[model samples]
Target: MGADGGTASALEQALSTYLAHLRVERGLSANTLAAYRRDLERYLAHLVASGRRRAEDVTAEDLSAFVTNLRTGDDGGRPLSPASTARSVAAVRGFHRFCSAEDGTPDPAVDLRGPSQARRLPKAISTSEVERLLDASSIGDGAVPLRDRALLELLYSTGARISEAVNLSVDDVDLEVGAVRLLGKGSKERVVPVGSFARRAVDAYLVRARPELAARGRGTPRIFLNTRGAPLSRQSAWAVLRVAAERAGLPHEISPHTLRHSFATHLLAGGADVRVVQELLGHASVTTTQIYTLVTPDTLREVYASAHPRAHD
Candidate 1:
């Protein structure tokens, strides 16, 4: 009953339409779009194999079975970890929801639930380690070092995600007011105060280093530039963090998000309210910011021991 002579072809057509919507309307990034494609392709293949040709034909039980298969790998592939399973479930659910909205079909994944995953605490570097990392960013006397230092300093100061940091324009940061405007996920913008240290570093880069770097290529307003004066890519930003971490003699692997986690954790440890940190981090919900509170359990224990009379006993 389809172009390719099977219901599977119809399902594939539906998937193509949904992916286009995500790309054009939702404005999902390429990496996110690819991930959704992989998850949903696998899911649709399972549905087709089970004779689910139409979205209206699928049931909630079928969605539940797919989740079980993902967890147990009963279909013969390697079993998915809890986190991967959750992501796949999310992709599949979103696909079904899109189909329902477009054609008014019953959403099979409406009540679907993902596996219970243990919440892992975000990894954060110590204050001393952060200092060392920042110092390492400015190891040499050159434009590159100056730019690297400013980039790292801003990352730690405002808790900007690596993408947001690299994508920043010159006008996004105001040294006079010591504030930086960050465009977050879904293009939501938030203004966060820049610390004195970061402002000084960025100031030095803007005044002394950026002019030289900006001369090599055509021209752009992006704050950070490579040697060719082009906007710095996310991979380049990641390489800067890796090189700095190695120079600082840090043992564990560190990513740009490590700085963000450190910023939130340090703020929470210093008695900053969770809501304020949420605003600084540009999180849509305070609930997302609450995870940083768990990182300071030792600090809480110390306070309880010092303040509560019966804490020691």
Candidate 2:
């Protein structure tokens, strides 16, 4: 109610109510609600530090100022990205709208417009680069090599988020059927098909590598395990990806999501239906998967520029 109660507390209460609305009324997924919480928390922190403590007390001027600060201020002295700032503004605007309807309060963010951000396309690795990474993982001829090969193959084959791939259980993978059950964002379950290469790599790891690792501790159902037989963590997965990329002589800045992007891009380029790709990627909306169409257009333009008879002057 007051500044001394802390802006965080007030915001937290408001967010809890809003999140409930999102879950029960709007039927939003848990992952989406979690993102909203994170965004609102950052906005509340910014407001509190600037002396605007209460949601009911927020003015259009205060909201605008917060947007300006997000665009320009150093977050802990490091520059904030324009894209991140835009997402923050969107989160704030959504919160204000929700608050207005639920709490019957004046919405200060009604007129708040997000800053224009550059539309950068998702980065995708070439099919050849992916093959090279997978091959490089198998060079060492040991349990680590088998594990690395399986992990890389699964990532590219399934287009799974790194978190989902690392969190897989042995029962989730069906080697005979060449399918894997992935727990995606919001704990949504989707069965994604795996390629033969990935299936063979996983089979090798299960038969040879996993048993050796599992011996270090009590047996668990986790598909991927560390050297100590524990489930693989997200950080370790990332490190493994980076190491494989480096060994394959790929770019140093590549991330695990690059495989995901490549998966979608390649599928779209090969005439896979948008809805089918959406199901494979576990996207709740087709709009989220439409970004790949932009990539397709770019690819067409490149092809036309190179091959059209009248294009070369």
Number of the top-ranking candidate, with TM-score as the measure: 1
Q: Write the per-residue lDDT of candidate 1 for residues 67-136, one digit (tens) a residue.
A: 9999898866568999999999999989889999999977888889899999999999999999999999
**lDDT score for candidate 2 against the true structure:** 0.83
- Candidate 2 per-residue lDDT, tens place, 20-59, comes to 8777877766667887777777677767776665677788
Tell me each candidate's TM-score: 0.90, 0.84
In model 1, what is the error at residue 101, expressed in angstroms?
A: 3.2
Q: Evaluate residue 19 in candidate 2 and report its C-alpha lDDT on the 0 to 100 scale.
A: 79
**Which portions of model 1 show Cα errors greater than 4 Å?**
1-6, 20-27, 72-78, 301-313
- Candidates' RMSD to native: 2.8, 4.0
The lDDT for every candidate, in the order shown, is 0.91, 0.83
Q: Write down the lDDT that model 1 would get.
A: 0.91
Model 1 / residue 224 / CA error / Å: 0.4
